[model samples]
Target chain A: MVSLQAAVESAAPVSRLHERASFDPADFPVPGGREEEWRFTPLRRLRRLHADGPLDAGKAGVEADAGPEITVVAAEHGDPRLGTAFVPADRVSARAFASFREATIVTIPGGVAAERPVVIRVRGEDAGQAAAGHVLVEAGANSSAVVVLEHAGSATYADNVEFLVGDGARLDVVSVQDWARDAVHLSHHHAVLGKDATFTHMAVTLGGDLVRLAPSVRYAGPGGNAELRGIYFADSGQHLEHRLFVDHARPDCRSRVTYKGALRGDGAHTVWIGDVVIRPEATGTDTYEANRNLVLTDGARADSVPNLEILTGEVVRAGHASASGRLEDEHLFYLTARGIPVEEARRLIIRGFFAELIGQIAADQVRAKVTAAIEAELDAMARAEGGAR
Target chain B: MSTLEIRGLHVSVAAQAGESREILRGVDLTVTAGQTHAIMGPNGSGKSTLAYSIAGHPKYRVTSGSVTLDGRDVLAMSVDERARAGLFLAMQYPVEVPGVTVSNFLRTAVTAVRGEAPKLREFVREMNGAMAALSIDPSFAQRNLNEGFSGGEKKRHEILQLQMLNPKIAILDETDSGLDIDALKVVSAGINAYRQSPDHGVLLITHYTRILRYVRPDFVHVFVGGRIVAEGGPELADELEASGYERFLAMEGAPA
Candidate 1:
């Protein structure tokens, strides 16, 4: 007979007991394949990021540069606002929280508006090394700013990032994971919005062996607004996942989430989960979330799940939707019926899918870079498939 | 001079559960350069299938027939290949291709058909000229192809593509079906300009002769149950206009 803890610690990948989100690492157990959240993720391919493994701060390289109106510091350890935004919902994020060596803090002065976006670049050096990272960002009252976090290179990385928005502040965060093919990344992003504050989070994932990201939003006061948007592309042998949660804890808050992804080639898989909860006390709340996935090849698979938990019938409105489908045959016929070839039509459709989101990027340079990357990925997909199906 | 010749053309489409139903049973017609042939038929008479079959739509299978464009075997070509071989099909219901703007869609088609991309200035001038002729808004060029477009807009957009492509043979499938009188005039004017090309051949498919008032046909064929049962001069359209297809539907043990 095997004990529950022993069973969870065992090598066999099975389902473990469930627990609510916890900030403490001990509150969570090693994830088996059966856990609701972990079932879609490939455990064996995670490179020990989900189980007990080496997490070295020295092995990871992070470079941070803040704008003139912003202040940045490398703190040794605990900040009272660290876990207030979001508790760890999985073992990997909890382990990252418990094992993070040094934390970076980005701060904006009260009522000071930043003209330029702050930039942070994280690059993993050794492919064999597993690393944990933590970042805390706080926006002062009535201050507005944008933050960009770009990831690249190769490593097994698990990290947590939190955003604390002050009243009447407007903040936009664009987190891009353009990792190497051998890299594995698991991250949790939590943003807490103050009264009348507006927050926008955009996640763009293009490269990784298996990258799982969960971004959640919570209201610290009434009249807060949150917008979450994401775009991802998965090629052969790549697994990319995004999970989002919007918790409307205060009254009269509004939230919107839209995510679009494309998958191509054999073994390419993408999973998107969107959850919105309107608490009973959160009357007059309005929220909508949608996820759309387009599969471009025969072997690629996309899974989209949208859940809405509305406890208050007095709320203004709430809805959620998720859909995943292959390239529409009617769209293809529309193009081929013209003189355009099948391959070119496929390219145009995929480009059109990402054009709307890419247009929302305020930084022209970043927008151009992301567009170039998308075009490159489309070219690669065209080459791999030889022609359109 | 160009010509689209169909000889004993028979087409079938797969029905549910692996059954094949013949839509076109021996359709025979010939369209020559500088000539407009209006094929008038009732509903379910397979007029649209004839146009689609000529464009190499995969849904319509050519069982036993010959469709040749200027002595070239058009039935052997792929859909895009057929379009490149000087064949253009203005669909009855233009498909909505989301994310692809009208400008991009036309540019791609023109490039594929002409084997070279048009000069930017020339392309813009031509597009503006065509849009002006059709009374389409300049902003329509930036909109996605046929998406959320009204029926009249879709028809005008189709003619816009026809004007840009300049194909040898143009098949207009129910181009006048949903157009208001005003839109019908604009679309007919665009087609008339294409007709001015000395080598252009037009095969107009319509259930009503309302469009014939604007774009006159040199020959009219009465199609019923996929075959041309009667052929006559322009007077035939007037005869059909005055007397409906009830005369043809009355024939028993024969194609409707």
Candidate 2:
């Protein structure tokens, strides 16, 4: 095992967070290339960030806005936990603290359903360094709220968010990871669900030099449910990866995940990994995971892996499926025969693929905003690839 | 004169490089404006191939033939271009587009066919009237194109598109399949409404004669072994429905 100090020394970019004292990349064990979980992932992307510059918080203008009733928690020296437990003092604490140095947290009181969305806007300043943040959402019992985390910046940055859902509570978290063209983004979101609690998380990754997001959910109580949906599109030289893990710890819990991605242009690689685990005590647990990828160009690549681990013999249902391929020519011909231009037809097909995920949004305003953002991203990508030729 | 004329039409299916199998077999048919022609046929009679070939499906190769819509060379254009040239095919299996709403698709199709943007109010009114005439729910306008739709709903949507686009020539392939009597009545009523246009021509293809009773056709052609072996008035459909395609198959010496 490599020590935090030694790992930081080995990875140059890890030195930038040294000042914050909470986020030490070296603390987290690097998965060997042989690990089953990291088998398909290109770990080289992380190694590249090793030599990057320290994140300049001043240059990376990350802003947070909350409703009047909501409380804003800032990352100050005294507030060490950042609203959630800073686990494994050397591991996530350093990263949480480094993020806390400028991170903002929003809290919705018990039984309060906020009409306005809590928006966290992150803008990067430099292209070399990375910036991360910790989002701690504690929805009290029977409470419901919506949070929108928007990532838009000119520089490269790494973002981390951890959420906790209370018993019988509901939380809707929508994340827009739209960064600069030359920036690299690595985001990890871990969620813990309580009894009868509901958690809905959606991610739209449209912009980044290289982007990777891992969203994991653990149902700790019986009858808990989690819905995870994601949409990503990558064009020319862009890499977008999403990995999801659903852990069912108790009986009668349900988990559903569906992710769709579209890749275009040369060297565009998009990956999806879905893992579901049903513990011994989690009998009668119902879980389904599916990932679908569409390759829109000759050189674009998509990799999908769906894995399920069932330890309970009494499990009711556990299934996983993965598919990756080029767009169906017959479907294209069908659309074109209706007089739709090829470009517009592609847009329709792509939009249709992500529509089911977007429709799951509970808030109309947030749904519309997300839809518009997706459209803008698609248009920009289409124009960029169109102009390249 | 409004007419879709196929003169010595020769079509083939591309099997491999420079390898094509003749399918249409030099078939000839004329559908003048203001007339509905029912092409009744058994399986593999090139009925669908002819329809798809006419609609410019790239898979269907027309080795030697001329398909002219109102004297315009349709075979020379692309599928969508032919649609803009006033041709429409109500697909037998309507493709389901999960995210596109019926109204958006209809608006786009109507705009493309008309070569102009349709005013929202007028388009909505027109669509609403059509849906009402077909006894369709107004909420259907916001649903995704044929996504999660019932069999009858899909057929109704096809006719809805036809009523909205109002093309010069419409080819409906197996539009009567999977439809109940009430739905069949609604679909026939929609087609009947479009038949009032003197410039409109319809070629309805079906395996059954149930729909012809509702929307009477001027001419009926029995397609067997990739050729139209028999032709007559509306009574021919009743005759075929009674005796089945056995007589036609016997006449052509082909297995039924």
Interface root mean square deviation per prediction: 1.2, 1.5
> What's the residue-level lDDT of B176 in candidate 2?
93
- The per-residue C-alpha lDDT of model 2 at residue A222 equals 89
Off by over 4 Å in 1: A1-19, A387-389, B251-256
Least well predicted 10-residue stretch by lDDT in candidate 2 chain B: B247-256
- What is candidate 2's lDDT per residue for B3-113, written digit by digit as tens? 899988878897779887888876789998889999999988889998999998878888887999888899988878988888889888887887888888888777777
Per-model TM values vs. the true structure: 0.95, 0.88
Measured on C-alpha atoms, candidate 2 has an lDDT of: 0.78
- CAPRI-wise, candidate 2 is medium
**Across residues A1-389, which tens digit of lDDT does each residue of candidate 1 receive?**
11224322433223222227776767778888897888899999988788888777436678788777789988765767577777787888888988888888899987988888888889988768899999988999999998899999997899999899999999999999999998899999989999999999999999889999999999999999998999999999999999888887789999999999999889999999887776667889988898999987788999898877666666777877788888887777778877889889888888887878888875666788899999999889877766544
Best by DockQ: 1
